[model samples]
Target: MAQNPAGASAAGKPRTLAGRCGSANWVCVAQCIDVTCVDKCLAEGCEQALDALAQCAEKSGCGPDDSACVSRVCGKQCGRTFEPAPPSPEKETTDPCADASVGAGKVPEEVVGRWTLEAASIRPEERPRLAGQEEGVDVKPRPDFESALVVTSGGCFLLRTKLEDATLGRGNTLEIRSWGAFQVDEKKDTVQVWTKSGQAVGPVCGKPRVIGLSKGKFQRPVYTYDVEGDTLTLTAQTPSRQTFQFRRQTQEQKEQAE
Candidate 1:
């Protein structure tokens, strides 16, 4: 398992994105209940959205009404009568993996440290064809022989895969997961990397998609990392053509404690 980012600078704790619940975000009715006495969401500019949801749910007999409300909230000051704004509403969203039945396991304590992406090996891919060529089109994930990103925890990573060119950019999802269960040996100066998913998977042209995998209990015994010169280097097997190096996160590099 890998560690989740913590401290002040860690990215916002991964949470469920709104539209991820279903194929859409504008839910006509709560999957379970509708509390608003009046039809059509009466959220006057998102300010009263949460309150309305809570009140409506309570009125409609939804148990723990407060927990049922979910809306995209803003952090702006909208005081018309010179009063503090109401707290934001909460919603019940399933983790993306939960739908696919994926769980965030406890990353090992040693793996809890940070690792810089010294190398990102993605294969060359074709741009989205306009038309006509759609049939024989061979679109694949662009190879990233080099790039930047940091690994938190030692398990699987779900990341935003964007390839940039000045202001213009191309994008897709990229998966880079460790091969097997992460085992730590602070005394041996070695970090064993194995494959649970057998091999790294895809560059599927979609955002928020799982790419590289280690599905079960880390299968492939792929790379081996050696802590050298304040950095970690990972080597892949033949035909894999990928090498990754990382540096243990230092105290200063740690996000300021929140």
Candidate 2:
């Protein structure tokens, strides 16, 4: 019998085709053409074509000795082409919160107590002058108002204010209540309050109107504090720069007043 180019005997002969062509190439040839054609092609020197088909099969992610891939790539190498698969889509990311803490902070133990507002005053330079008023003259009259502050040990606070409304009838008061959490830095002598909720109940526009306070209107009401005996003085550092003197209230006094 004549020796094949692959160094294997013809089919039905003693020698097998395993060593001459690798398992993958043998499978590819078997899938693409008949055994007689494989022997003839090898005899005719089709080694270069077989090598190119194997390379195309590797690039197209064909399984080792895959019969289906051999049939598709080798049998149709003349007209068919192969391309790599597309990548998968990426997952969407989550959005972050604007303010996760919302100004949450700790309050010092020394300043955690109920304080009654004794007096409130504004500096002459900080006060806005009246229209057409003389430079040295101070004509703006102060509004009659009273306020009280309560600071709990749990870092919470409440501020209640009652101002006599001159526009409304006599004895009519504009009552305002604000409550929130407080943060204090004793080393810096500064204290700040985060107003979470508030409301106003009084006569306005010819009727008794209860209006909710604009939450977070006072973004940063920072104040420098000084405690002397039973008195605590808080001087505002932003917004309306004013001084507020408060007297510490005893539990008996608070109960009696309430």
Distance (Å) between predicted and true CA of 78, model 1?
44
| 1-258: candidate 2 lDDT, tens digit per residue | 001212222322222132231222222222111122233423333344445544555575556545455445444441121110111122211111122343345566667677876655533442353335543342222355445676665666666555452311232234455566667877899877665655544543223444444322333357788888889877777443456678898888679546
What clash pairs does model 2 have?
none
Instruction: List candidate 2 segments past 4 Å from native.
Output: 1-105, 126-144, 165-167, 202-209, 214-216, 238-241, 250-253
> Best candidate, lDDT-wise?
2
